[model samples]
Target: MERKVPTGIYGLDELIGGGFRNNSVNMIFGGTGVGKTTFSMQFINYGLNRGEKGIYISMEMTEEQIIRESKQIGWGEIEKHIEKGRLRIIHTHGEDIVILSRFLQDIEEEIGEEEVRLAIDPLTPIIYNVQQKRHRKTISEFFNGLRRFGTSVVTLEEMEGVEMMPLYLADSVIKLQSLGYGERYDRTLRIVKYRGGKHGEGLYPFSIERGLGIVVDVTEEQINRVTPKMKYREYFEDAKRKIRQVEGELREALLNKIEALETSWTRDESPERVLQMFFRTELGREI
Candidate 1:
């Protein structure tokens, strides 16, 4: 089995096929105020709770600022973790970054730690200020340096109209988007890439709460209310009939997928979600 690590964000791991691959580097990118920093902090806290040491290297925020914000979100134990040396927060000034590759090499040489969870918040500052000719090479080298500490999550600020180099180098990519302003705004997350898992695609709604942190918006109550096994049998037969009604080429494809779905049911996978995906993708309708 591929070793995986939980992201600690509610309802997200299941969508990404059971968290991230261990020892892999993942990148989270978003516009300003889109919760990249909060997500990164939550990831570190989750690992800390799991008895794993964590490191957070911030370019835009001070160690105190990070602790203060973490406290605001009810992560009171953050200070204790720091005091006990379970977590280390590093502040890298966002000064000249012309030689960011060399800078990262120096930082990695300084730490000399292995297999720790690392989060670099706002990697954009350094990469953004680097000279254009060496952009991709520099970004690749920075990621190579991060691997010295094991599985890493790097957060980057999304420039208004510029494509970032780190987005392509990371093992996986998660994008957060909050559109509009104020009460009418909508927040969504997309797993743009997951290197080795059958992850869910497209946008998923999510919200940030005081105690819960990031929670994916799931319509379980309205759409996935559990039914007894006898009722499931009835639905299963009905699904078979519906699949039979599909036209030639699509019918063959649905049959193959439905067989997989049948096996999934035995594993206690969400029948509602499977059926919904069937309807949405195969039939272009909803359950």
Candidate 2:
């Protein structure tokens, strides 16, 4: 398997073959309030937390505004990362392609060959600022420049014709939709295209939560893979029986924890390994 740069969005990496391909450009497009900026922030913040350097180039927001929004969403350590020189935020006007090109060149020279994560919130303005006849040349050059910075997550506003160019050019394209149905503000994410990888094909339900950013609901397929062909309850039956030997309130607590695991465990560990660890550590006996 090729090395991947995890997007750091919960439940998203699994859907995109571990994560975005290393050094690839990924596009995230959505309408207003569909959490596009939050998605970009989460990707950069994920790298920053891991001590990996990140650069955020914002055409829509100022440095102060971006920092304030990051803190409001519970990413309070963003300022510290900036102070430590692990992360940088550049605020620029998108319409000036000449100036933006110079900034990108300077960034590339400074970053050199280091593996860094780059985030461009709402790349629409830059693309839209160019003449229609020059879009191909302009977008190609822009995306090529971004690839030099290692892995990148670029956000785009989903206008009727504005997205087709970027969507076609990106290594992987993720579409975020705001499905306004009645009183609910339901949102979904779909993998529009992945150049060289298999990806989830359906609309994945997701929610934007405080501190968590975008939380994707784990599909039944993801949960079921932990125990192939075997139901979780049947796989853990022997472990449950072992828990019966555990007496008092501890017994009930153990059983409840097991029940929770049966429904909520989405990791790659097999049920046998999980149950073995559970019995060995919790009950002090092998099942």
Candidate 3:
């Protein structure tokens, strides 16, 4: 079996055969306000929490804007991760293809042999800046460089009639669609392709929550059938209050994780079991 890198988004891993294939380049395309950036950030944050490094290269937003927006969506540890050398964020500001290529080389050198997760938000700037004749070569080289950094998730804006070359180069492709029908199921996710693994078929309903980035509504009926009825929100709140008792950085990290769980806790296991696991992993102690 191929080594899998777990995507931090709740309920997404099980759909893509336990996460993305290790060292593979994945592409996510979506229209505006369709949760593409959130998906990429969640992938990077997931790696950072597990002691893996991450690099976020943004062509649109600045470092300050990214940090502020991330905190607004409940990823409080992004600044802390950067301070501790676990994460690095770069803003290209629509730089040319040459400068972007140089940035990738410098990152590869800095990472050395350590595996790192990479996120490039809206790759349209870099790829579209080049000539049409060079699109194939540029995309091929760019995808190859991303693979060296371990696993990567790159986002692209969904244009009406434009053909995206990255879609063909990527090992996996996930397309996020916004139906705009103003219903509960306005947004949906579809796995367009997974090179070597079987993935869930059909469009899955999803929502972009405040704390939780993108929660894919998969396996809800199965979880409901197996798990007993309980007040998940009440239990999550109690855990949050307890987490507030701790001081300093650990407290902030714990609270962030708990808040995300509060928004998308749909597992078959009880919340108490999940809380215990968090305590043991983060605090190195039993609750």
Candidate 4:
């Protein structure tokens, strides 16, 4: 049997075939006012449903604010878990990022002792702090440190223009796109990439309401299919091997042309001119 993890999403599990694998850094990125926080709540809710303890790390929202917003979405049951000592909410303090980095370090020490599933809401504060404070070195080290702890982490990131700052760092990058049509808006989620793991492609719609909590409408596949008309890994590997072969041939052809130019000499041209000619001819363009 294939082991699976729960994503705490509505209709998404069927799309990915299962949840995200254990100990992977899963990132959710989008513009402001998207469902990033709600999605975070859903994951914590999933852990709660499974009777696992969870921790909510907030850099912007107060713990009370989180509870209230959750209640508005009918996830007020979150408080019950807190009451049972199954959930912990940590608010971000001064110099937001330094405080939070210290906070994450502290939590790392506590995870094993507490066995808590953690969710860090809105990664903007962390990125902003690093940029404003010139802590690029520390930020990367911090991310790698957290991954070393081997816990399920979902961090929310905000993207503007075409930047890969945090996206390049995460093991999995999930993009939540928000679209407005007429007077209504919709949110969609897609895995931009999943390192060392498999995921579904394209966008999947999501919705949230007080009574329904959160829901996703996506495609489904036969999870039990034992036979295949095609096997992706084997076929994809073959394609890659062929592409490598073509690239090698092109590279060797270029090298041979360069060597051929070195053997030819023109006595009429100056030394500099001769070298330039060799470069242009061998490169097949202006060098």
Provide the lowest-lDDT 10-residue window in model 2.
223-232
Clashes of 2: 0
> Count of backbone clashes for each model?
0, 0, 0, 0
Across 66-96, the per-residue lDDT of candidate 4 in tens digits comes to 9999888888788899899788888874354
Return whichever of 3 and 4 wins on TM-score.
3
Candidate 2 Cα outliers beyond 4 Å, as residue runs: 99-103, 160-163, 182-185, 222-287
**lDDT by residue for model 3 (22-140), tens:** 99999999998899999999999989988899999898889899999899999999999999999989787544555557767877876788889999998877766664676788778
Which portions of model 3 miss their true places by more than 4 Å? 99-101, 160-162, 220-287
Query: Which structure is stronger by lDDT: 1 or 2?
Result: 2
Candidate order (TM-score): 2, 3, 1, 4
Please give me the total number of clashing residue pairs in predicted model 4. 0
Which candidate tops lDDT? 3
The positional error of residue 65 in candidate 1, measured at the CA in angstroms, is 0.8
lDDT of each: 0.77, 0.82, 0.83, 0.64
lDDT order of candidates, top first: 3, 2, 1, 4
